[model samples]
Target chain A: MFPVFEIFGKQIGVYGIMAAVGFVACFLVGRLLIRRYDIDIYDFALTMIAAGIGMAIGASLLYAATNYRYLFYGFSHFYEIGWSGLWMCVKTALDGFVFYGGFIGAAIGILIYTKCAKDVKAHRDHLLDIYAVLVPLFHGFGRVGCFFGGCCYGIESPFGFTVHNNHLNPAINDVNRFPVQLLESGCNLLIFLLLLVLFKKHIMEKRLIYLYLLIYPIVRFSDEFLRGDGIRGSLFGLSTSQWVSIILFIFALVMLPIKTKKLKAQSAQAAESDAD
Target chain B: MEQQQGKKGFAIASLVLGIVACVISWWGLVLGIIGIICAVIGLILAIQAQKSYKAIGQKNGVATAGLVLSIIGLILSIIGTIACGIVCAAGTAIANDSRIANQLLDQISSSVN
Candidate 1:
């Protein structure tokens, strides 16, 4: 019902609009990072444009795939399947946006673009450091978009934070859902601010990105419990994302020590070479 | 010179093949295997060309193109595989439901008669 919005014969949805708003916010934040850090990646706007195109394509593809039944059969076979059929499919896929899919897609896009540039490979360390911070800032915008679209609604709660009858979908009708999306958006905003503060103090580098890798998965895993409509099914008695989070958390922890050792060794070598 | 061009041609051909595989079929196990091949070759070429570009004090636009194309191709193929998974899951669900429904209806009819 809250699917389409028409203005001057042009149609849009809260999902798409909020996504765009998120992108704009990300662009502005990226611009701020550029000025603060003296990053010399192409003009900020061009980078934003390229990233925007990549995220848009990747997000829509993931959404369509995750909800393939709704996207193809439900929407296309309306005459044969009827409204109920389509509704079921839509409800099935409307639980939330797939974050892993978006993360992987955007990472590939940024890595390719950066590697292709003439100077980027030479400045790989600095470029990566800057990107580490930018990722969370941009991700914060996406969580906000998720909040407005009401896709990742929360489960029932006695707390007053529950959202009732969002009207975005029938499946979540009259339930006091947890507002999990809002919680995520808030956490991401805090993470973004923390990254900003760390970057200002110059205490962040590759380590900062590692922190994000640790923090986001933990947040997502905890929030997974509150999600009412999405893929909450257990795999080995744990939700899929929670399991993934556990795996990723361990991976990040293992990598942290290795990364720190590598950095130290490199710095020592540089110092010896400089003395020579 | 011709061999290098041929190699570049081969890489480009694979990249295009991968893209089409991703766009049309969008989901299949085989597409991912092929996509991996395309991405690997493309990545190698891109890195090699980048080294050559540095040696010559210039940029390698062709190699960059290969990298970008291969990356997009890889992403699309991966997406296609995921789509295939969702399709399989939905199909299985519907099939199971129909089977259960028919069984229940048969049991009820037999009992009533």
Candidate 2:
């Protein structure tokens, strides 16, 4: 529950610290991989920057969408509250963001980066394979941050530790709750390791990204059930993330075969050309 | 070859900036903010370095390390800023509430006396 800590009279957020650590770890690991694969570092840096921007935008937009009441209230009372209030409302809206939105945004960013960068476009499959592993590695750190920040808490459960004075969510306070954040973080780490091993072994080839898409959605779909927070909107009796997971899972399922077939065809053509 | 030499200079500069950013990030919010700015510039330099390296068919590990460190510094600084904001807001709210409570108590005592 230690969201903020002071050092040398300056407050530091644990979540931010963890995220920073994650980003560094991801970058270092990915750099090693880029070297191994002989990928273009400049293109990698550009793609990362694009993805970071996209994630920031997507996360904030989705947060605002899910918490529409805040916007409605702010708009309705805009005249009465004036500029300072409106500014505060905007600040508040930007503070909390959904991870799924960031994920989707990053994917879109990578796609756009690939389209624009000719060198990266040529090595899209390999880059995507690296990205697939990076996502989970970064996300795992984020989950740890969530746990310390006392956000995205799980339902009351006698099996887990009780939280006290949880500043982020009072509902989670004074009750034993499942450590869903830690569980998810652990799961993500496992997935990262698995993907890394598969990648090193050259097991899945170009289908690695699809494998991640297929696997993570299922984990997320089930994990949503354990999640206690309702800040992330719901539709048709399922949370926004759950719905997104289902959609993504289906998309991955459909795209897997198509992409595999396309790759096989391309390879066959290359082989024939080489033979000639 | 000249441009390649210039790129190497950028890579070294980026690496130095990245290290400075990461170190200064822990000092204070103001320093952290400066670190973030430095990190952004460092990242740009690292990218340039990488592009140059690619042109020369060489791998620039220093540029990669610089890019990684810079990103980490930026994230830390941003988090430090948010933490400061939250703490400040909470402090202000508490002070206001205490002031109102003290004023009410003083008024009650004066009236009773």
Candidate 2 residue-wise lDDT, B1-113, digit = tens: 76855488888888988988888887765687688778877887888887887787788789888877876767767677533123212221122355643453344334433
Interface RMSD per candidate: 12.0, 9.4
lDDT of 1 at A59: 55
The true-versus-predicted C-alpha distance at residue A75 of model 1, in Å, is 17
Residue A42 in model 1: shift from native, Å? 2.4
Candidate that scores best on lDDT:
2
What is each model's TM-score for chain A? 0.77, 0.94
Candidate 1: the clashing residue pairs are A154-A178, B26-B80
Model 1 chain B poorest ten-residue lDDT run? B83-92
- lDDT (Cα, tens digit) per residue for candidate 1, span B4-105: 333455445545654554454333445554664555455445554545455556655566676567556644443333221122222212223556434533
Tell me the docking grade of candidate 2: incorrect
Per-residue lDDT, model 2, residue A161, is 71
